[model samples]
Target: MLYIQEMHEGMKVAGIYLCKSRTAAVTKNGKNYDNVILMDKTGTIDAKIWEPDSAGIEEFDALEYVDVVGDVTKYNGNLQMSLKRARKAREGEYDPKEYLPTSDKNTEDMYKALLTFVDKVENPYLHKLLEKYFREDAAFAYRFKTASAAKTVHHSFIGGLLQHTLYVTNLCYYFTKYYPILNRDLLLTAAICHDIGKTVEISAFPENDYTDDGQLLGHIMIGAEMIHDTAKEIPGFPKKLESDLKHCILAHHGEYEFGSPKKPALAEALALNLADNADARLEFITELFKANMQKPDSEWFGFNRLLESNFRKTGDLNAL
Candidate 1:
């Protein structure tokens, strides 16, 4: 099968792909078309059935595996497809694993590394809370490891939540060594549990879409609530400690405009917020390079909306 990332202009496309989305549209001349987004593990691409009402176009919708025959074309510097034929793939006709994106790192290894940090937490209440979710709660542990950090953006693949958590935790660990003022246990605990609410915010793979709770409350609020509820169950948990920890999660985004419910109030909260931003931006840029790496001759990849600037590779050091 041809992955979306491997596709180029003027290539003929024929194979099964996951239909991530499908919508009807009308052209200026009133011609009907079906705007579709096709997906595979590598990534997704835009597709269109220009003649939706014409014969040979099969019935299918979002979330179904589709068999398509089309010509790859370029529109406004992006690759798109002009489909001639399409149909809903029969059950067992295609492999489901090929359609979902997955992380390159092993999930188990990442989880174990996270537990090492948990072992380091000296605060009894915080340590117990970490164990309640990561070590003792079998179902939550499985979901946390498997869930994506977001529906899109950085770390949007399987094992993404765990991967992001580990990266953030590593950064937090370094902060504890360099900055003696920041509470090590609080910072590390906040980092590990930062995006745990994503397990409920975004559904598991195949769909990987937002749930009702995700749409209504979002991961930030959901996560804070989860932390509060869990802490209440632990005996002798301090009230001030719980508030401080929740503040870190709520303000991790760092600003109100960025979806943070509050700005960082404590030194530890500030450090966690900065670390989260750095890791997220780094991952986002890495994904940008990977997606556009197909163009070997081009130096400039054009402007990135996420980064708010144009980007170019520095090329190999050996060549220099």
Candidate 2:
């Protein structure tokens, strides 16, 4: 199979890929075309059907599998497909798993690492709260382990949520070590629970897009509500601790412009906000580099809206 990542300009590709989305549009010249997004485990690529009425073109819709024959082309520094033909694949033609992108890391290993942080929470109330969702709830544990952190940004593959949670937790753990002024227990708890709502925010793989709840409530608000409702079940859970934890979740985005319902107020909340932002931005840049790995090491990658800059690979150390 030709993975999307392995595709390059001028290559001819023929394989079955999931149709992530499709749309009909009219060119400025009044010609009609179909814009499509195709996906395989490696990543997604934009595709265009310039002659939609061509006899060989088969009918298909978004979320269906289709066999495509196309020429790769570069547009605006990104690889895209200029389609020659496409047809819906038959039942025995493809495996669904091949079309979903997944984390290279083992999901179980990521979950275990997250638990180590959970075990370190010394505060009794915080510890119990963590235990309720992560330890005691089996269904939630499975969902959390399998969920993606987002539909597109940073970690968007299967097991991505757990991988991202562990990274943020590790970062928060180190922050507490280097700066003892921060509350280790509070910050770590916030880190693990920060994106927990993502389990519901985005649907599972193959349909890893926003849920109705995700659109209406978002992960931040949903996560805060999850923590609050769970804490209410614990006997004699401290009201102030619950409030502080929710505050951490609500304010973790750091600013109103960034979707943070409340800006970081507590010292621990501030630490978590910084850790979360740094991890997300760094991971995004790393993925951008990987997608363009075939380009010359010194070649400029392209302008990145997220980082607000163009990027290029540093020279190889061996050359030095």
Candidate 3:
């Protein structure tokens, strides 16, 4: 199978891919066209059917797997496809697994590593809270392990939420080591639970789009609510401790402009914010580099909205 990531300009594409989305539109010249996004485990590509009514084009909709024949072309420095033909793929013709992006790491191993952090929480209340979600809840554990962290940004593959959580937790653990004033249990617990809301925020693939709740309330708000409700169920859970933990989750984004409902008000909240932002931004850059591997190492990719600047690979210095 020709994965989206392996495609290049001037290549002929003829394969079965999941039609992530499709939209009808009219060109400025009054010609009609269909905008489509095709997906496989590697990634997604923007495609267009210039002649949607052509005999070669058959009925197909978003989220359906289709056999597509197209020519890869570059537009605005990005790869796109001009489709010649497309038809809904039969069930036996395509494997569903190939169409979903997944983390390179093993989900089971990552889940175990996450539990290790849960074990590290020394505060009795925090430990029980962590245990309730991480160790005891089988259904939630399955969703959390398989869910993506975001719709399109960093860590958008299966097992992404778990992988991002573990990375943030590890970073917070290191911060506690250097800054003894930070509450290790509080920070670590916040790190693990920080993105738990994401389990419901984004639906499981092959349609990893935002849920209605995700669009309305977002993961930050949902996560804070989750923490609050869970703590209420635990007997004698300290009110101050519950408030502190929710504060960390609510303020992890660090600013209102970034969608944080509250800014960091506690030492642990501040640490969680730094750790979450660092992991997310670094992973964004990492995925950017991977997607642009075909380009020359020294060539600047261009200005990225998320990075807020032009970016590119620093070519290997050892070869110099």
Candidate 4:
């Protein structure tokens, strides 16, 4: 099992990988080729079949496990594969678990930790709302547990939504302690529900891409709608409280250009936004460093579009 992260330039790639996508394209010289993305739990790498119609290439499609033979090469600072032979893998030929990226943390443990926060919500209506999804709904619980926080960015793995929710919830909980002006219950409740729409926004792996709703409405809008629909079911749910919580979800992105339907208006909404952004950026950097572990500390990875800066590892204190 040669994971994508372990691959290097000039290496011969021969393994079963999930064909994340496949597209046909024509070269300027009028030659036809297939653009493919081969994925495993470690990550994804771009691959190309220069001779798609040749005898060595067999029928395969996106989301199918494929047996591939290729050579690894560097292109524009990223690793890519030039595939020689490819075929649809038999069911027994690959483990489905190996093809999906997953969190290092335990999913059950993270869910339990998230539940503790639900327990801490002293407000009955908010507590019931949390219980309705996290404790009572079996189907939603499974999707929430398995869903990724994003299609490509931070926490993009199985159990990612749960892991990310816990991190942001923990951060909001801490913020409540330091900033007494923030409403503990509202802030924490909003944190727990902030990304709930992601369960529907991104389809489950190995097809962890945006759903139709995701492309049209996105997680913020979808999440606010989920909260509105659910809160309506809770008898005696306070209208003001429901509105505030939904505002937090709609504004968690904190800015108009960032896809937030509304900017943070409440103190708690602002706190939730800060916490969400902090966790996302920190996790993004953590994953970035992990992906570039093979490079020396002094070498700049290059300009990252998300961070809008070139990044490199800092010197180790122990070495100093």
Best by TM-score: 4
RMSD, candidate 3, Å: 2.4
After superposition, which runs of candidate 3 have C-alpha atoms over 4 Å from their true positions?
Answer: 28-31, 296-299, 315-320
Q: Lowest summed lDDT over 10 consecutive residues: which window, candidate 4?
A: 311-320
What does candidate 1's lDDT look like per residue over 13-102, in tens digits?
A: 999999999999999998889899999998889999999977879899999999999999999988999999999999989989898999
What stretches of model 4 exceed 4 Å from their correct place? 296-299, 315-320
Ranking by lDDT: 4, 3, 1, 2
Return whichever of 1 and 2 wins on lDDT.
1
- Candidate 3 TM-score to native: 0.93
How many Å off is the CA of 33 in candidate 1? 2.9
True-structure RMSD, every candidate: 2.4, 2.6, 2.4, 2.3
The digit string of per-residue lDDT tens for model 4 on 40-77 reads 99899999999999999999999999999999999988
